[model samples]
Target: MSAGSRVELYAAIRRDARAGMSGRELQRRHGVGWRTVQAALASAWPAQRAPYPPRASKLDPFKPVIDQILVVDLDTPRKQRHTITRIFNRLCAEHGMTDVSYPVVRAYVAQRRPEIRTEHGRTESAAFVPQTHLPGREAEVDFGEISVRLRGELVTLHLFSLRMSYSGKAVHRVSATGGQEAFFEGHVHAFKVLGGVPAGRIRYDNLKAAVAQVIGFSRQRVETDRWVAFRSHFNVDAFYCQPGISGAHEKGGVEGDIGRFRRNHLVPVPEVDSLRELNEFIDDYDRADDDRRIGHRVHTVGEAFAAERQLLKPLPVEPFETGLWMTPRVDRFAQITVRSNRCSVPSRFIGRQVRVLLHASDLAVYDGRTPVASHERLLTKGACRLELDHYLEALIRKPGALPGATALEQARAAGAFTTVHDAWWAAACKAHGDADGTRALVEVLLLHRHTPHEHVIAGITAALRAGALTADAVALEARRAAEPIDSAVPEADGHTAILTPDAAVVASLTHRRLTHLPADTRPPPTVTAYDQLLRQTTS
Candidate 1:
């Protein structure tokens, strides 16, 4: 028997023995093993005079007072309000109530806690029609919370997801914050992944990012200006579902997708050293999800998307820059602060109105229609100081004129210029003096304006090796090297010199040419005539 059962058995045995009842009777009464009854009888605390019923709660008498306190202090925070122990002490000291124990007070408080319900208001369930959404016609968007180990810190990351209702296509991204900036960035990335914008309306939860207030299931209070601007830029309509009504049936496709992704991919929590690395891994996972098959469709999500790609709206000529636009006063230093990072305008812009275009990746400064400067977006919020390197060229040319450079000095002091061209300046200064080297380095930097940095560096190195270390010389060489060469060689003529053969007849002749006789030459004819005449006379 368990200890409790043993205790009960012991009590039952004691009760039966005091009543002069047998062990059998005790077992029958208590429903315990005979061994338990015998063991209880062996030894232990002295038996009580009579069996006692469970005691009534000591705080039962103070129930009315506790309820009255809760009624008056309903608005107070639970921790700040009177706790069980506190109430017990108060009762003993002030009310002369001493019987109530901590347990009794705790039970009484637990019973009363549920009775104090504060109602904000009742929300009506939205009436929704089960529309048969066509393929490529509708997409559902939502945000989920994920814990990611970023740079060794456990951060709550917002994962924005877009799921096509038909093909079950999904796009997911991790953002540090779940504000409008993150919302727009998520859309931008989702569009790129889909390779085009969806043709149908998008469904979204009544989040502050997309909606300003809940008017009803069909209508919402005025949308935020940022969201309106986004809708205008993308030329798509946004729809909102009733608050607190998110479920699998309403957005079943994406709801399941979020769970699947969370369980299969997000579990174990990804530990990434950098945001870029985390984003890269997310891209890979997105591609894998797009390539997977859904339902009974023989085609993969990528294939289905290919068929639907043509139906999507064409992207605008200039893609939307994800940012929150704001107007802030230029400080005496000609700088405006956004999320604590300072950005500078020309000193001329000081006291004058200028526009700040903030983006997830960059910050653009504009005066009227013309853009004044652009810088990479600052990730953290705080006094983001501007860097002088951003406007040094403009400042130097308009020296002493202020050029209305508001944030230039702030930007300068922010160490922005420290690294902008530090390496190039260092190299140039090392090779030459400060003025000449900086000028040369500036020219080298200018090369990057036209060519890639790698090519510029290579050209600089080549120039230094060839003894053309001056900025002008290096720049000229770089220009010449960049020109295209005619790779084809020219054609040649066919003519060649030749020597004529000599005759052998000259070999037979002496140094001087002898006079040749006519056809019947001299000696043979005279000898024959003299011999014939002598023979005739002797006969």
Candidate 2:
């Protein structure tokens, strides 16, 4: 209604009241409700009306069901949790609640979902008390998943970041896993990088690597035994935040560092040859980040860290072993199983137990205290990392297996079995039958144990060209390839180099011999041995 009309209505009612007209009579004459009559009698202008009481919604009966579903959804994966339509359908089917419309359900769910989340402690409320941090007293640690291309393969690595609560200085490393070993190793890396352990407690979430169980919504935790040992060894005082909020509010420094570092430094998805390379990249960024000023601070991160370093506790003289120690028996195939992944050892180690030092990224097999083999740790279950050199003895005995061996396949993939090796093997197989040729190739492969790999390859190429398909001939050629020209000496046996050296190639050595003897003595170097190829060809 227009204000002028409302004013005229109120004026007529008030003028009647001033002339002693009854309230009921004014209401009847004005054709208005008693509330309007009272309002007009009370004032010449309209006053704001009192709000009406809320009427119950059709969804009221099913709200408890909605709350129960949302409460259960807290334990479910986010994507698999309930939706409004799903809730509405459940209410219709299970509770026989068809009176509630879809719009009503959606509206109630929209209003109640977050409230339910907060009530159940699945979400933190927006308001948080601001905290004052003292230097060297506290730190925060967490792991975040980061994807990078390692040697042209896209691999997801867990990045461990530890940020000083006061200084904003942090250290970051990428590991193959976020398991306990990596967790412990990450702490060691941070402590070493920062030069000491925090004098006060380090804040952490309920990481499975540390906390085996959160004690029912409280700050208490049943920590893993290994984590307890690690903490004691490092002289670390560990403080776990309340389980419900996931410790993010208490440890925002490391939480923010993980995201901020990933955005500013790890963007474009770093491509590196190894985890070592990726970590070096992270280290460079961390050093550069030290100069950054955090949130109106007078001192830069590095400057603050420099002051904080003096307050840190000195590290222990003895270091803790971060790798897991195990003794896995080598199987018949000369392979040992470490956490469901297979790695090969030398054939001699078969049926024997070898000590394994398994780190996050790799595992090393030791015969007693002497390290025998080490392979990069395999992430996928049942995966194998076979080294061909470990199987050479077996391959020499059963040459048939050499062609189809998994070790050979891995060697080929690793470039240890090159095209040159394949070419030489093919040539040998052509000269002899497949079995004998492969046997001879195996013998040639055995030369790699004593001879340089490049020299062995050269020997194979030379023997293939000369049609000397025997392994002995390849060995002779390999020795000749390894010999220096001036120091070349002929073996006084049936075996000799197929090709003789030219005089000009060793003229200095020949001149020295002639000068020591009479002029006619010490005849010049000859290619007469080389001419045996022509004679045999003609015959």
Please list the C-alpha lDDT of all candidates, in the order they appear.
0.69, 0.87
Q: What is the C-alpha lDDT profile of model 2 across 329-421, one tens digit per residue?
A: 999999988888888999999999999998878788899999999888776789999998898878777888888798898888877798988
User: What would the TM-scores of all predictions be?
Assistant: 0.48, 0.70
Clashes of each: 21, 0
Off by over 4 Å in 2: 1-126, 244-246, 450-455, 466-539
In model 1, the Cα lDDT at residue 148 comes to 82
- TM-score, candidate 1, is 0.48
Top model number, lDDT: 2
In model 1, the runs with Cα more than 4 Å from the true position are 1-53, 70-108, 115-140, 144-158, 163-170, 175-185, 188-203, 212-220, 224-277, 286-341, 344-358, 364-374, 380-382, 385-389, 392-539
Per-residue C-alpha lDDT of model 1 across residues 325-426, encoded as one tens digit per residue: 777777766678777677666566777777787754456888877887776555456746455444445443444433234443443455333343455556
